[model samples]
Each structure stands twice: as C-alpha cells, then as structure tokens.
Target: MDFDRKQLTNEQLLDLYKKLLKPRLIEEKMLILIRQGKVSKWFSGIGQEAISVGVTAVLHKDEYILPMHRNLAVFTGRDIPLYRLFSQWQGKANGFTKGRDRSFHFGTQEFKIIGMISHLGPQLGVADGIALAHKLRNEGKVTAVFTGEGATSEGDFHEALNIAAVWELPVMFIIENNGYGLSTPTNEQYRCENIADKGIGYGIESHIIDGNNILEVYTKLDALATSMRENPRPVLLEFKTFRMRGHEEASGTKYVPQELMDMWAVKDPVTNYREYLKTEKVLTDEYDEALRAELKKEIDEHYQQASAEPAIEANLSEELNDVYKTYVFEEVNSKSNSENVRMIDAISQGLKQSMERHDKLVIMGQDIAEYGGAFKITDGFVAQFGKDRVRNTPICESAIVSAGMGLSINGYKSVIEMQFADFVSTGFNPIVNYLAKVHYRWQENADVVVRMPCGAGVQAGPFHSQTNEAWFTKTPGLKVVYPAFPYDAKGLLATAINDPNPVMFFEHKALYRSMYQDVPTDYYTLPFGKASLIKEGDDVTIISFGAGVHWALETLAKKPEINADLLDLRTLQPLDMEAIFTSVKKTGKAIILQEDTLFGGIASDIAAMIMENCFEHLDAPVKRVGSLESAIPFTKALEDQYLPKARFETALAELIAY
Candidate 1:
C-alpha cells in the first residue's frame, strides 16, 4: 500500500506544516502561561500534532469530529476562532462553556465538534452514534474520533469498535499511540502487540503509520477519507508517536526516563516539519522567522483580548436555569377509553402510539426487534414499525446509550431499553456524564428515553433486579420517573419519550403484569414534578414511589385505623416538593417509603426535605421504611424479607403511636 500511495505536492506539504505549527505555538505559549501561574494547566501534543492536522485536513466542515484534549490542533484546522479558544481557557463569558468548565471540555454545535468530557472512553461510543445518524440519513459523511493508547483499555473503547465494525459505520477510530497512559506505560496498559491489531479482530480495516511525518499522515488520511465516502466503512488507524511533555504543564516528565525523552525530542513533529518545509524550498530563513513571529503575535493578542472579556458572575439563584428544558403538558386525545389493561400492554401501546404519531421516534435494545426484548415490552414492535425504527442492538449497553445520544443530537427522538435496571452500571458514563450534561453545556437537546425495568420480588436475584433511581436522582440534567400503576406507566412513558431531555423511566419488574388498571389508550402526557395523591387523609402523610407505593397502599388497608395521605412521587428527579410540603403541613407528620436499601436511598433524601420544610409542624420525627442494606437474594422468602411491606407496617404503627 505504501508503494502504491501518491506523493504530496510541495504546496500541500507546506499547508500541512503551517497547520501543525499553529497548535505547537499555542501549546508553547500555554506552557509559559502555566509557568507564570496565568493558566491553570495544559495538555500538550508537541510530538503528535501531525495526527490531528492530517486528519482534519481531509474532513469536510459539515462532518463531525470529537477531539480529545491533546487533539487541540483539530480545532485550529477546523478554523475555530483562536479568541474563543483562549476565552474558554481563561474562563471568560465568551468561552465555549461560558466558563462553566475548563479547557477542552466544551463543544460548539455550529462546528459539529462535540467537546470531549474528562472521561476518555465515552466519546468513541458517542462517535458511533453520530456515524449512525449519517448512515441512517444516507449522508455520505464520516465521523472522526481521537483518543490515545490508554483509552483503548476501557470497555467502551472495545464496545464502540465492535459495534462500528458490526454495522460497517463510516467512522475513523484514530489512536495516537504516544506510548503512555498518563504515568502508566503502554506495556502495562495492554498485552496486545499494537492497538491497531485489536481492531482486526472486530473485522475492521486496521493501519499503522509513522505519526511524526506530516506528509505521510496527510496523504494516507486523504486516501482513507475518500474511500470511506464511497464505501462507508470504519477504519482503525494507529499513529505511532510520543508525548513530548508531561501529562500536563504542572507535572514534569519525572515518571518518563531521561533517555526516552531525549530520543523522542530529536524526532519532534513540529521541528521536523519545519525543517522539511525549508528543505522542500517551501520556506526560507527569513520566511520561517516571520511565520514564527506572526503566530506568536497572533497568539499573544488572542490571549489578551480573551482575558479582557467579562468573567461569568456567580449566581446561586439561577443555578438550575438550564439544567433541563422547560416542558408544558398538553392534552392528547384518547384513542380508546378502555380500563381493562395490563401494565406491560399499556407501555407497549404508549410506545406504539408515540412512534405512529412521530415518525422520527426510534426504539433500540438487545433482543428488541424479533425477540421483542427480554420481557416483551417492545414485542411485535419490529413487525409494525420495521427493523430500522425498532432496532435490535448488540449487547453493548454503553454503545446503546451513545447511539441514542447521537440520534438525539441529529434531531431524532430515541427510546432506549436496558434489558434490566441492574445492568445500567455498564452504561452509566454516557448517561450521567455526556447525555446528562449536553443541555447544560451546549444547550443541545438530547431527547432520549431509557426504559428501566427495575425492582426485586420476582425472584430475578441481585444481577437482574435493582431499584437504583436514587443514583440518577442526585445527578443534574436528568429526569427520573418511576410509575406504580398501568395508567401512570402508559401516560408517563409517553410523556417521557416526547419530553426534550434525557429521561430514565424505571418500571418495576414485579408490576409489569401483576399490576392491572384502567388506563386511557390515548395520546396524553402526564406532567412531571407533580405527585399523584392516591388517597387524602390528615392523620399522617405517606410518601412513596414505584413498587413501594403498592406496599404503602397495602399497609394503609391493613391498618384502617391509620388515616394517611398517600402521595405517589411519579418523577423523583424533578421532585414534587410543593405537594410533599403541603401534605406534610396538613398532617404534621411524614413517612417515606422506598424499595431500595435504607442506606442513602430516596427515602433518606425525602425525609430530610420534609424535616427542613415542616420541622415546626411535626408531631414526631419523620419515619423512613426501605429495603434492608443487602443485595436482593434469589429466593422469594429472603427477597420478601429484604424489601419493605412488613417494615412499612411496623413503621406506620410506630408513627401512629408517636
């Protein structure tokens, strides 16, 4: 392939040289600023700028690029204004995240570059989603993602590569093998001969190249980009390079050997390209000095102008202003007013109606297409909506969420189903870090719905049953909904799909078929952050959600002497604290019930909130009843003892007596 490759003209080589020089100068300037205590820290790619320059030179403006911190040259090649970059570094209002985040942690929707998060692996999976949208739209565009050798050791890296190969998506997985993962060496990271070899097993084309040479990178990437435009296949290209500096400006290369540093310094990409330009007659002594002077002046001016911009003022009152998009509930006509419906059937109907109403809505999960999902919630969906709309995904949870994020960014609503809630830990990074922060950082709507089948009591054991909504409720920019009855499940799931934010809809596994109620088979969206007052009485106020609501209701029936105002907190994230406060004020006592463990559960949070708001009106201390602080067992007897019905009855009697 090298023998058959075309040579680059002198003019083209010169352009690549200048592109490499700009970021090198910026890194050098930033390093000085760090020494002067002007900038906080910096991640330099002094020896690997050619990788970014070569790749960005071949990409179109409309195509997307997700760049890591070391790949700052990609922004320069994309023509993003230097002042904006400086403003971001200086933490000014003119910066990308408006000074909310530091360094390469922001994105521009206009440039189609999603700013990479601090975590390394999620971006690769997210790039799969962007490529998926391009493929689905028949757009002959490719998405290029940059990461290092250490990132490939992450599970998401393998998940991203596997799915990209399986789908034959137009994605370029570029790995800059700089031989270090922060302080850890490459050998300690993986046992493989090379990172590119890992891609070969995924059935994708793999290539390794000399990353120090600017012309070599540009020529090869140019050819690869052209071929992908026509054939649309992912390419795993490894750029063998070195990190010339420490991980950041503050941390010097003490962990790196002096001999290794001396060896890589001789082959520095920027200096090597500068000499290559001079030898090729593209630069003279005077021109080289003038170019350096011009770049330095420009970098200095941008830094000064960005530093003079207004700094963002701290305002605690408007903290949650842009955390979630404001949603207003609108009336949707009921197609059928039937009351006889099971919870699973109601959820299926909601998904079907929403898909039929909005042509852009898509449902994706493992065994969802023909097998109809693990519990058959999305069964028969493929036959009705076709496999494209009702997609059967590979068993990669992280990729599934990333694909949904990519779809939402491209103006599509995605409904993703995790086979069970216990498995959400596998996909937690994208959901919490990327999808949850998109709106707050970029104001971009990631309209994705993750259907979570949670809770124990069906003998699914610790691996399958989990009520982990508490973990997500504490995270900002996410909506957590747990419905108890069929009516709320159908209405809330419909609303969640239509809502313009990332939503986690948790449906208890035990209530899927056991809980039946008269649900309206219509297009209606229930308002989030509003609790349903199941029964109103003033003796005591009981707060519950999901399967725990049934336990509370059962306890109330068992002890008819205890008059309680039972409130169902439908959405836990945007908590209905107003409803809670009102009920607590009337009753003068409160009891919080949940199916999760008592240690650091939703019950604990709600009990605190009640104590804060109604401390004066309290007749007694706020009581909380939840599952035991242990994993849910396989046997029904142990599971029953672990969960809350018996505990709730005991707590209810104590609260009434108190």
Candidate 2:
C-alpha cells in the first residue's frame, strides 16, 4: 500500500517536527491577536498540521488543493504569504478581503491551492472539478481535497464521492478526522465507525492513517496522491487527528467532557511530532531551538508588516474589470417594451439563443437535457445540441456545480439549473469557491451560469418556494441577479451567459408564469451593474431588486400619498452604487426591500451604504422590508407571513408619512 514509504532521515524527521510546530505557534499567536483586539476571531489548525503539510508535499505542484477553514498548513506549505495570512485574521484594510470577506477563505492560485472555502464538505465537490479538468486536459495531476470528520456526514461529501467514483476521477479525498465539529464528537453525529468506511458505497479505495504520526500521514497520503496522479482514479483517506486547542476563537471548550478532553490531550499532533523526533533520534536540541526562534521571528515580522500594509487598493473604475470585461456588457439602459412574450417563454428563448450563439454554451442538470429543465427553460436543447453538450446529470447539487466549473475552466459555458433556489444550498461551496474564485485566484475567469428558480409566491411551501438570493450575495466574486419583468429577465440572463464569470441567475418561479411586460423579438442583453429606474420621483426612493421591484411598483400604483423611485439592480454582484447614490441623494429617503430574511441580508449592505456615505442626504431613517430571521414555513398562512409583501402598504405609508 505504501510503495514509496521510507524510513525518514534524521533531518527529514526534524522538518516534520518544525512543520507541526508552526501551526501551534500560529494558532497561539492568533489567539493573542483575538484577545489583543488585533483580530476578530480564528479557528485553530493546531493539532492537524502534520497531515496537511505531509499530504501536500506528496502531491504534485500542479495538482489541486482544496482545504477547509482549519487547515492553514496547506496555505503555509503551498507558499501563501504569512503577511497576507495574518492580515486576513486582522480584518484590517490589508486583510484578505479588505475586511469584506470571511476569515477562513484563505489560500490562492499562486500557491496552487486550487480553491479554499470555509464551509464544510463542499471542497470535495471542487476537487472533483479539478480532477475533471485534469482528465480533459490529459494532465497526469491529481486533485487533493481535505475535510473534517463531520464534513463527511454532509450531503456534499457523499454526492462528490459518488460522482468521482463513477467517473474514476483523479482525486484523493483526505478526511482530517479532528474528532469534533465544534463541541459535538463524531460519534454523536455520525453513526459510521470511520469516515473512510463510508466510502464503501462509492466503491473507491480508502484507508485510515495515524494522523498524529507524521510518517504515517506522509507515507499513506503520498502513495494515494501519487497513484491517483499516475493511474488517474479516485481514492479516499481518513486521517485520525486531534484538536488540542479550542475549535475557534468563540469555542472555549466549556462543553467538552473532561474524560474525552483528557483522552485526546496527550495525542496533540505538535506534541506527538516533537516526541517522535526525539524518540527516533532524528533532531538535535540545538537545531530544534534555532528552528523555533527562526519561525517565531518570521511570524512576528510578517504580522507587523501585514498589519501595517496598505489595503490592496482596487480602482473603482477598475472594479468593472473584476466583474466583467467591458465588451461583454454594453450599456443600454432601455428596458424592452416591444410586443408579445411571456416570462417563461422569454427565459426559454434567451437560453436557446445564447446556446445557439456560443458553441461553448451547454446546459446540464436533473431532467435538463431530456425533460428540458424543471420549468422547461431549456426545452428542446437535448434534441438539438446532442447529449454530449446537453447531458442530464444525476440529482447531486455539489457535483452539478463542481462539474460545471470544470467545464467552464476548459472554455465551456456551463449552465446548471437548480430545481429551485432554496435547494441551491447543497451546491453553495462550488458556486462560491471554484466558480466564483477561479478568476481571482488564477486570474482566469469561467463562463458559468446557474439558473435557480427563487421567490415565495403561489404558496408552494417552504422547501419548494423560498427566496434564498442573499445566501449568495454574501459571497464575493459571484454575480447574483434577480429580474422582475420578462424583458429584463431575458436580457440579464443572456448577459450572464456571455459574461466570463459565475452568475447566480435567479428566475423567480412566481414571476416565471406571470404575463408581465412585452419582450422584443430581436435578441438583446442588458449589461451588468446597471439598474432600471421604473418610476423616477423625488418623494421616496424605494431601492429594490428582483421580485421586490415589482412589489414596489404595485404598491406605488395603489397609493397616491407616495411616488417611489424604483431601482432594480438587475445584476446584484456588480451593484450600481452610482444609481443608489443618485436616487438616495435626490429623494432624500431610502427604503430597501427583498424577499430574503432581514438579518445579514444584502439589504444590510444597502443600509450601511446609506448610513456611511449618504447619511447627510437622508431626510428620514432608511427602512427595510424583508422576512423575519427564521426558516421559511410550510403552510400558506406562515409562508405569507415569512415573505416581504407589498401588503406592507401601511409600512410604506408610514415611511412617507415620516
């Protein structure tokens, strides 16, 4: 099993010790940063560094690396700068996102850390994508993705593994079994004895390794990683590791049972590696002390430099480049007013036209090819395009997105349809990490479009009909668009297909069947980041997007007391801040609305914009109309109560009355 396993030389063993030590030191330093008010919070990679470095060292440099939040060792070994790493934790101007992005989404393409996402299990799907790309390009590289034991229980973990096994993808999935998901032990969550054993259903080679033993992790992972690269098949490994420190900055170990705490305390990966080196007579005290001091000095220097480093100033003018190439989006502010086209028909026409225009464009998803998508947006594509391009996929959200990204990386315009937007959560990682990040990391963009039916009318209940747009709005590098009228829907969707980036094109299921404004016969596309001013007025600026725009319009029609200026951000990601600023400036009032939950939604960003930049221009406090922070309910009555309604007519009156 271990073809290349060798007895480590004294120097090699010393290197393992040092690698393990770096994580512990970095984690502790991060804890100090958290306490000193330098960084907000962090998850420690303390007891799991050996597996990360050892496994990565075995894989080829061109091979992909997808690691979860707790594995900074992958970033460190892959050569992600310590300054950028520490700056990410500090949440300063120099932070990973200029303090705009989440903390654990670290690593970059420069490191060949293919894609990194904080959410659990999703990395497995992204690894599938990287492997698929390797297969297509005839490359002998493997894709290595890591996850915690808890991530193994996720639907994405199973979905990705199944597809990789089916395709025999060149992938080595390593489960970093660090004993717990926060405080809940693996035993409490998963019924399986071992995460590796769970791979039996997928019919892939799997192994369990002593993750605390650097040699074991290195030898086991190295063989599997090499085998996948050379032979090009899927393999799975479970690294039995531990967590000596608390889970994250928020976790205090207050809930950990004293018995299990004592059980794992002695097996700390860093401590184990240090002791193993001494026992094997591999390292001298002098070499060890010098290495420790050098690492400490390096850490201190990088922290100071990164903390003080100026933010990566992206020119606002250049922000357009970050979203789309100038040629893809030609500014044409006029909404289509020509005769005769229903909303659903417009969507179908748009897809057909785009696919016909670009030979690279292909549609795939459950029932998409043959049945023509859940709502028939892709009707007749399979018959015309052939199964190779318009093939139907098995019902696996993770695989759908990951595979689409793979196709996109190799110059394919992949369009995936989630049966409903609420169901898109299953593929959230691939959308955010691979589809969204490939361009930023490798400086190469993907033309991937995900058409998800969203919104909460027609009473389809919670699971089938709930708006989940903002779930994606939180993630950068991905465009989220929601169109109200048939013309904008068709135009925006067409624009998204042409753009060289991932787009969450939300087709409101509620509006899909509704006969709205007439669309033009001539195929046309609306540019990204431009909003439609439905009614320009100086009374109250009702800033909205997607389904909310229609709702705002209807409310304005019925009420005489208020004349609202409606701005529909047809493309959510490249938000038209200029339009927002102008509207708020003139109207001297802002009321943001959407069908998603109020807490942590995109409306918050709009509110923050108003408060920070346009505070002096506002005559009244900004108002937001959205569902209360809770899961969507199943019953019709509860569903009505869960969404942001135009029935908030009284609320609008109140805003204008102020």
Candidate 3:
C-alpha cells in the first residue's frame, strides 16, 4: 500500500507487493460491504489486479487514462485513495464527482484521469480526442484507453484506430480481453485469432501479452508507453486475462460454461501471480501476510472515512443546467418567399454561405470529402473550402460525433453527418453523455451540428431507412431541426452550425432530390426554434416537419375542398411551441405527421404538447401519422407497406372527410 505513495526505493520490493495486493483487498472489502448492505455498487477488479497495476506501473500520473468500468483498480494503483473510489462506488458526495456521477464515472484533474464512460466504444474516441488535443497543443503526454474485447465490434473502435493511426496520436488502445464481454465470448464477436490482430488494419504496433504476469505486463506496457510518448503513434495491446467475478454485481454468470470456468479459473492472475512470487523467492509468507494486513487497514480506514462523508446534496438539480452558456443564439423564425430551389442545392448553398460568413465553421462525415457526402450535401464544399474544413471520416459514428464535440470544445463550428440517420444510434452515447452534458458539466458550450439523412420512405430498409429523430428528441440541451425544403434546409443548417449547442439537423433523403425552392445567394443565417406556416387554413392544423411537410402540401393540393393550416416545425426540440399552439388554436383540429415510427415517435410528443398547452383550444381530437410500430422490412413491397407515404393518402382522406 505504501508503494502507491510515489517515491520508490531498491529495498522496497515488499511495498510494491502491497501495491498490487491493495486493489483486490479493496474489492474484497467492498464485496463484504455489499453483502452487509453498506455498499450499493462496485466493480471488482478481482482476478485482473496484475493487469491494472502492471500496466499503470509504467504509466506516468500526468498522462491521460481513458479507463473502462473495472479499471478503477488502476486509479487505486495511483495516489487516488480507496475511500474516494468507494465513495464513487456508493454514489456519495465524498467522491471526486461529489455524487453527480454513477459508478466508475468519477475522476478528477488531480488524477489526470478522464472520467470513465459506461457506454462501450465511446472511450476510444474520447481518448483519441484528448490525445488529439495533446497533439494540437504540442504536448508530449500520452493517452491510454482501457476497453474490452466485445467493444472491438463497435464501429467507434475501428474508426478511432484508423484516425489515431493516421494522425500518429500518442495513444495506447488496451483491450482487457478477459474471456468475455458480459458473458458473450470473444470468439463469437470477432474472427481474428488474437485481439491485437485488429491493430494491423490500422497500421499500428500490436502486442499480445500474458496479462496475468506482472513482470510481463509491466515490461510490455512500459516499452510501448515509452515508444508511444516519443513516436506519438497509436498502439494496440491485447491483455489475455480472465474475469474472476461476474461483470457486475447482481449479474448472473449462467452463460459461462463450467468447462470454460475450470479452464480460466486456474489461470486467475491474482492467484497465479501470488504463487509465482512465493515460489520465486521474491516474496515470503510473512511478507504476504503483512501486506494483506496493511492493505486491510487501509481499506478499513478508507471505508470509515467514506461512510462518514456528507450525503449527496440536491442543489444541483438536473434541470438547473447550462447546456449552452453565454452564447448569442436566437431561435430561428422561418421566412416564406415565392421562391423555389432544389433541396440538395439548398443544403450546399446554405453551407457554402455559412462558410463564407463564419471562418471557423467546419464539416465532417463519411464519404463527405471525396464524394461530397453520400447525398451531395457537401458537393463543391471541399473544393471551395478545402479538405481540412470539410473532412471525411472512416465510418465511425461515435468517434465522428465525439471528434466533432472535441472540435467544438476548442471553438470550431463542427457539423458531422451520420450518413443515414438510422446510423445515428451508433453515436448515441456521445450525443447523450458528452455532447449533451459538456456545457452543463464543463460550463463551456460545444457548438456542434450533427446532420443526418433521415426518414424511411426511400425503401432503403432497416439499416439505411429510418426516421429516428425522436431518439434524441427527449434529450434536453439538444436542438433538433428538420429542414423540409431547399430554403428551409439551407437557412436552418446555417443556423444550427452557428448555434453554440449540439443540434441534430435531419435532412430527409426523399426531400434531398425531390423538392425545389429558390434560396437567396446572400449570406444570411436563420434563427433557431422557429416554424413556418407553409399554407394557412382555419379548419385544421397539419403539424409536421421534413417529409411530413411535403406530404401535407401534396395532400392539400390534391384536395382543395379540404382546408388545413400547415405549420412546419423547423426546429423540433425547443420546439416552436408558439407557432404550434397558435396554429392549433386557430384551427381547433390537429393531425401530427412524421416519417418515424409511431412508437416513441415525435408525433406522440407533439400530441402530448398540444394536449398539455392547447387542449382546451381544440375542437376535435388530435391524430398522428407515422410508420407502423414494427421493424422496417427489407422487401421493397414490405418497406413501402411499412412507410408513411403508403398510408398518408388514406389518413388524409379520413381526416379531410371528417
């Protein structure tokens, strides 16, 4: 335990022994505490203490550590007291997060540790981004990211490796391949014989080590850590170990076979290493017993201190958040003109105009650089503004988004596309955790615009076709906009990019090429949170955005006998409630339409909003139109059958006839 105090001596090998033993002892103490109902949450780094201490033995305290959930042992290996770690586990105010974070999500500037993100694969990008910052600042420190074998399957892992390798970042991507990612065996996840082999695709040095051996783990990580700090390139390390306990408390290990457990339990790093030390004459029975006693005392003192700290406070309510701070952002009001322009051209021109006005505006996405984006939204953008501004990514949605947030952190208007909006789920964690809370937590605004090709009418099936705008709709501190026409698309995109908060700007794939409306060439930006009254009527309010607007217009054009007020909600979150309430109040009847699924769709949210604020003003019940509540089928016929366009005419007929 004393070896964790920083200063080491040649005769202090016994103290070093205590350092390795402390984490497991701490975990054992926490486990008993759990049984006694004193501790609520804890990730036991039980069997793999060697991997944590051994690897961190070579790492400097000043360097960055993008630790995983169980890597709290590494934090304990350093100067972070067991009390604070346990306080974090107990979700108490004594922890560095002061009770704001859940288990393993707490760290501090003193630790030089980036807080652990619970979601898999996101740390790869956050590690890469912090490394990117170190590189940009011309610092020599390195970033070591801890992840699991199962996380390698995530797109962000591949993308982070590709970006890190290409940039030659000072990072070590370490995979604690502990046989299973929450009971899903590694064999089922990847075909590569060794986890380190995945690094070859990224052109980085890869090492597979006997992770249970302290000497080997330390030596391998030490050499790599040296090369990483000097060469400033990425490295992948596969730590072959086993999880002695279930992935989490209250987690069942029924999925683990007895044969596999028998095979791995013998190779348990802590037991084998302890025996190895005893057999090698490096440690004595007295030394082992004494180390255990000292570690126990430290654990006891820490727990007592943790239990005595003040309880969690409620002053920092979740709603009292500053998601965007001191930013001159005005809500956009839509302006209608008798002008027509192509949706694709509107997007391009809008970005083009924004780039002209704002010097720091930048765009990034897959296929955006060479192909000018999959739908030509970035066409002529790279050529005009250069590749640095309109950069292309390697199909890593999570990393792509986190990188955009990183860009925004240092003052750049980052606009990233998720290709098809359906793929946005891949980056959901970063959007929800980092992008959404960065302003609130760090008290700094990360002005980033996330653009996606959304909706399901194109018959692209489950993977490519989806109207999932609502996935992030309920996520406060984020502004989501659906640009319907060329003019609206252009103006809103400009507005989103310039705004100092994360914005999801969804462009319908069907509208990209279908509708044409003239957009002015003048460099102008629109405000956020505004709606456009496309067509005014006194009978009913057709509430929609994106493809819904097009459907409403077409429906009205086909039936001149039916009068409806069409209000386009240019911005979804921080919705144009004024316009929606006004139009619905005027018409006294409402029909909400969106191309997303009816289950968890934005229509339901709009309906709830109307019912909450404008219910008494309504004459008839509010109705919603969206995709059926089922997985989008691959067959073109089935896909069409599942899409809103197939049912739009019928719904409109019924609504109008009523």
Candidate 4:
C-alpha cells in the first residue's frame, strides 16, 4: 500500500496526531514523577509512540492487544482513561490490579489489553491462542502482539510465530526495532538485516516500515488488519525506530554512543509528526496552541488527582484471595467398587466423559490426535470429538501452555498435555510465570489443565522419567494433583477438568497399565485438598502420594506388626493438612515418602508441616523417604537401585523402631 495524504481527511489526521501526542506528554510527566521519587521507574516510549498509536488505530475497540512495557500509547489509543493510567502509576487503590503490580504490567478485561511481563516473549504464543479462539468462534477479531527486536531472538518468538503460521491464526505480530534491547545493540544480537525476514520461513507475510513515519505505519497496519480478519493468516511486521532515553529512568545507558543518540535526536517522531501536521495545514497555529494547552491541563489535573488518591494499604488476606476458584460438583451414590480398569483406560474414560459433559472443552498436545499422545491416552478422542477440539500442536512446550491459557481467556476449557515430565523445563516460563499468575493478576479464569507423565520406575532415562511436582507445589495459584490408584486418577482428573483454575496434573507413567482397581462407572468428582486413607492403624502414620503411595502400602503390608495408618494425598498444592494432622495425632510417629529426589522434594514439605502442627503428639522425629539426588539412570539395575522398595521399607522400619 502506498502512502497517500489524500487518503485520509484533515480531521482524521489531526485525530491520529492527538493519539500519538497523549502518550508522549504522559511519559514526560512520568519522567518528572521518577525524578520526584514518586515512581520507582519509567520506560519511556517517547520516539516510538507513533508506531503503537498507528497499530492501535487500525484495531477495533474490542480487539485484544498484548503490549510490552514501552507501548503506553496502546492504552491511550484503546480508550483506557488517562486518569486510570495515572492511578496505576501512582499505586492508588483504584488501579487495574488494585495496586498489586506497578508500571505497565497491569491489564483489565474491559480494555482487552494483557498486562506485560518482563520476560517480553511468552505472550506472543498466548496471542496465538486468543486468535485461534476467535477464528474457531467465527468472530471477526484480530490480535496485535508487540515485542522488541531483541525479544525476537528468544525461543518463545519462534515457537509462537511458527504455530501461528501453521494454524493460520489471525494475529498481527509487530516488532519494534528500537536499535537496542535494554543495552545490547541489534548488531551484536543477530546478523540479519531485518527481523521480518525470519517470518518468510513460516510462510507468513512480512512487512518492514519506518516506525517514525506515522502515515506509513498506519496505512500498512490498516491494510494487513483488514485482510487478516477475512483470510485468517498471521502477519509479521517490523517497524524501525530508536529509543530516545535510557532503557528505564534508572538505567545508566552508558553503552549507547553519543553520536548515535545525536543522530536519532534529529529525527524524533513526536517532533517530526507535529511538523508534518503543520506542513499539511492540518493544524492552525491557534488550534495547535489550544490543543497543547488542553492536553497539558488535562494531564496535569489527572496526575494531581491520581496522586492525591489514597495509596493501597497492605492486606495479607486480600493478597491471598482469588488464587483458586471454588467449584461444586453434585455427589452420586457412593460405591467402593464397580468394574476393574487399568489406570490408562480410566484416564481416557475420564477425559471422554468430561468432554461429553462440556461442549466447549478442548484437549491439545503433541501427537495427541490419531497418534494418541506418545502413550495412547487419547486413542479414540479425535474420532469422538473431531480434530478441531482434540488439537495436535507443534513440538513447542511454551506454545502449548500459552495457547491453552489463551483459549481459557476466551471462555474455553483447555486440557494441555506435556509429552513427558522432564520436558516441562522447556515450557516452564509460561507455566510458572504466566499461567500460574494469570488468576491472581486480574482475577481471570485460567481454566486449563496441564497433564504431565511423570515418575522414574519406567527406565526411560532422565529425559522421560521425572517427578517434578515439588516445583509446582511451591508456586501459588496452581493446583497440583497426583493420584495413586485407577479410581482416584479417574475421579480426580474429572474434577481437575471441571474446576476453574490452572491445574498441574501429574500421571505416573509407571502406574498407567501396571495398576488396576475397580472404579465407579458413573460420573463423579473427588473433593480437592482431601486425602484418602488406604489403611487404618495406630502404631505409625505413613503419608505418601502418587506412585509412592503404593510403595508405602506394600511396605506396611509386609510388616504386619507395625500397625501403620497409610494416607494418600491426592492433591499436592491443596494438601490434606487435616488428614496429616489427624493421622499424626493418632499414630504419634510419621513417615513421608515420594518418588522425586530427597532434597527439596514433597517429602520435606510434608515433614515440615507435620512437625509444625503435630509437635505435641509426636513420639519420634518425622522421617522422609525418596530417591537419591542423582538423575534417573537408564539401566534397570541402576534405576532400581536409585528408586528401590528397600529404601522405602528401611525408612519405614526406622521410623517404627524409633
């Protein structure tokens, strides 16, 4: 599309100028706030406001925006009130996050803008999910996700772009080439001439434009946005500009050369745009003066009013609230037995039943379609639910989790599966940083379940076998469930999918086909944060979860004289503290067992909780039994030695003797 001044009327041009000017002026005032010690930091969007404003102009009022910290003009162009922006910066009680987060890292559903994370690249994949949902719903909406040239080097950039391209999602991936990423120059980062060139490999249309040229930015983005809405294709756009100030008000920026700064100073976007408006006779001198006065007075008044508003007081209870959504499922007739089933079969049945109950529920993972997910857990799902709902995603962990959250944001329940537990490290950023924090940040429903095949008894080596539930147990706003028996696995999994929160569901790979139990055929949901007592006794209490529960139960069975009370914790995050306390108070001695490494494992946490609550009832110190700190080996001999039944039995006997 060629830039033609005749395309837009003078009034439209003047309106675009105001959108560009508001953020520039607001940032100037923000810099003053930093200097006055009111704000701790400021990421100035001084020279790049034109690009964000132009992109936002092309988007509809309800279109979603995934913006970074430097794109303040997006809020202005999206019609978020200036006073709210000021209130957010001032840390007032009326801020978007209730003053929980500072700076540009807060978003509200009303504005359709996602709060930015400092990592800068994870949200692009999330944007892909939102676009995917819009396409599925036949909604004529597009998502614009902003990032920097430096962030494009991150792995998340490729994962997001590749999936978006392969799915033909309606997303506009815009990169702001501001010469430097924090302090590193673009030349030092990548040898490519343009970041948009990378988009060609994914079969996406790429565009390069001068970000300082407001007309070019607006015209190019407007054309792409219009075309993508109908055609449903991802677009990558790179806009060249420069950062006029330090990375933040507190950053020294000594590495930036004075000569380069001087060169960019001569081409300031705000000054250039004003000059162009005047040259086109779009703004008379008197009109310009009055516009400037009006903007200055409004901004000053907003800042003063926002600053005077009461600061949010520290509230421990409120901070802990809204972490998890409370869900209620009706109870059916209680039954201890119905028909024998394997763990794998029970899981597949549970998933099938849940999907049948909820029409909007979706399941996505690698090779989960006809391939049945590496483990054949979803063998007949595609035939039943169709390929649209049982999506087979690319080999990208971050994209899998992020896209699931995106779908959840658009009112769909997603069950995302990580192929193996050890592979979760690749997708940890989105899981820990974004999905786990989504509910707390804006009280949004992150109604997604991430299933991980875990445990080490399979001899699949370090790459496949792992028990990493302890990592998620420490993270707030996530529910971690690991069931030991087939009945528990089926019942708990049904609850996990129905409940409205992000759940990290760990399924022990070794227990899938090896364990068999009579599970109820009827639909049911087990209560979260409650434990199941496998055996009742009074000499000692054994607490375990997942595969370790079987190990401990067997150990106790062999030693009949111990008279142990065995407890199986179904959920790790919402732990059954009451169950632990009751059993500990009865038996007086306790043992905690797990399949993860001994140090920093769930066993340590259970031991700590027992001591904290049952100090007076204890007859001996709490004992923890788990695998050694070394990684799981490949050979059967070494793997057996690493996680041996003898280790657990020995620990159990020691606690009994003491």
Candidate 2 per-residue lDDT over residues 1-658, each given as its tens digit: 1112286566666666666777677877888888888777777777678788887778776666877777778777766668878877665555444454556664455566644555566667767766776775578887788878877778888888888887788888888888888888887988888888877888998988877777788876766766666788888888887776677867777777788778777777676666656665666678778888998999999998987776566567654355433344654443445777778998888888788888767677788877888888878887887775676777798877977765665456778889888788877767776667655543557678888888777787768877777778778678888888898888888888888778899888878887566777657888778888888888988888777887887888787667778888887787898999899999998888878888878888988998898899999999988886787777778877777774456667888889
Alpha-carbon TM-score of each model against the true structure: 0.96, 0.69, 0.78, 0.97
User: Model 2, residue 331: displacement in angstroms?
Assistant: 6.4
Q: Please write out the lDDT profile of model 1 over residues 326-403, one tens digit for every residue.
A: 777665657766778888998988889899988888888889999999999888888888987888888899978987
* lDDT for predicted candidate 3 compared with the true structure: 0.76
Quality of model 2 by C-alpha lDDT: 0.76
lDDT of 3 at 170: 84
Model 3: how far is 289 from its true place, Å?
9.7
Residue pairs in steric clash, candidate 4?
none
- What lDDT would candidate 1 get against the real structure? 0.87
Query: Which pairs clash in model 3?
Result: 331-527, 331-528, 332-527, 332-528, 339-518, 340-517, 340-518, 341-516, 341-517, 341-518
Clash totals, every prediction? 1, 0, 10, 0
Model 3 lDDT, residue 359, Cα: 73
lDDT of 4: 0.86
